[model samples]
Target: MAEQRRRLDPAARRLEIIETAERLLARDGETVRVEDVVAAAGAAKGTFYHYFPTWDDLLDALRTRTFEHFDARYQLPTEVDGPIDWMRVLDELAAAFVGFTLGQERLHDVLFHSDFARRRPLPADQNATIRLAAVIRAGQEAGVFAGLDPEPTARLLFAVLHETADAVAEGEDCERSLAALQVVLRRALAARPEEGSAQ
Candidate 1:
């Protein structure tokens, strides 16, 4: 049998409890309870109470859980070596986001519709800045992007990508949305030379 790991500190225990509770929430839907969380993590009610004083606190924990989660859960593939085209990277990222959203729609609805988005602010690591930098760098090298502010461009990319999920969740034509977004991305990232050419 594999050895069971243990946490020694109170703070780690509390985080463990929160993370375990999130798993229950993800797996059991809305039926999960605080007792279930304490029981599963093998922590006492005292520990749970110390971490979160009331139902609201637990809900707060859940919100933080959702925020950290969406950042790490569906990250881009690591095997993609040798820099790829910016727009192509966006295409892959869009598909990944849509797929991840669809898979986690139930939990996502709880997080967004219930104001969980407001609980945990965006973390630096989860900021998508590095991903954006990668795309911007590649586009620059390929001579397809110039006179652009990479950081803001990344933010803009995120806004456009968010629309994909909105269309999907609204039961609109998802494929049409994806296609339309792809075109928009291609235009946004298209090369612009220093000298003007006749239109």
Candidate 2:
């Protein structure tokens, strides 16, 4: 067992360190140190360095991992039987965003409010905006939503959800914030009468 443990794959070892760090961060907040991560992961200081060149690099990896996990939880369905209820989808996304943020308040703060997270360039494809954009595009194509550009509309909705999440994190009511967000989204995305007549 000892020898087998010694031969763990490099990628798997790296993941172990990251996961261990996450648990430690949850328990200790930003006070978790590299030594703590190495001890919890059963890795040497050198081993941690092998995967993460610096402390910031590890934090960045954690932020990306957390964001990806958050995004995966709120994905809109790809296939539907008929005209998609874009409003319902937006509500679901808003609720999920609020739920995740409130549930993981400490981790969310570390990942989203940290300086590293702010400085990181969030690629459109890797973030929630892209998924929302796809749904908006589908709604537009199906004539169920306004004919605004999907990317910008998606970004606007994403910004609203992001701010709502932040508010919920800061002790605001989740349901109220989510309802407000849904209201804004419904109004903005609703197809205008003139637009329907034009179509």
Give the best candidate by TM-score: 2
Instruction: Record all residue pairs in model 2 with backbone atoms less than 3 Å apart, i.e. clashing.
Output: none
Please give each candidate's TM-score.
0.62, 0.79
Q: Give the Å error, residue 30, model 1.
A: 8.8
Model 2, 31-61: lDDT tens per residue? Answer: 7889999987778899999899998899888
Q: Candidate 1 residues 75-132, lDDT tens each?
A: 5434268555666766877777777666665665555445544665445654555566
Kindly give the stretch of ten consecutive residues in candidate 2 with the minimal lDDT sum. Answer: 75-84
After superposing candidate 1, which stretches have Cα over 4 Å from the reference? 1-20, 23-36, 39-43, 47-83, 109-119, 193-199
Top-lDDT structure, candidate number: 2
Q: What is candidate 1's local distance difference test score?
A: 0.68
In model 2, the runs with Cα more than 4 Å from the true position are 1-9, 27-29, 80-82, 196-199
All models: lDDT?
Answer: 0.68, 0.79
| lDDT of candidate 2 at residue 192, scale 0 to 100 | 83
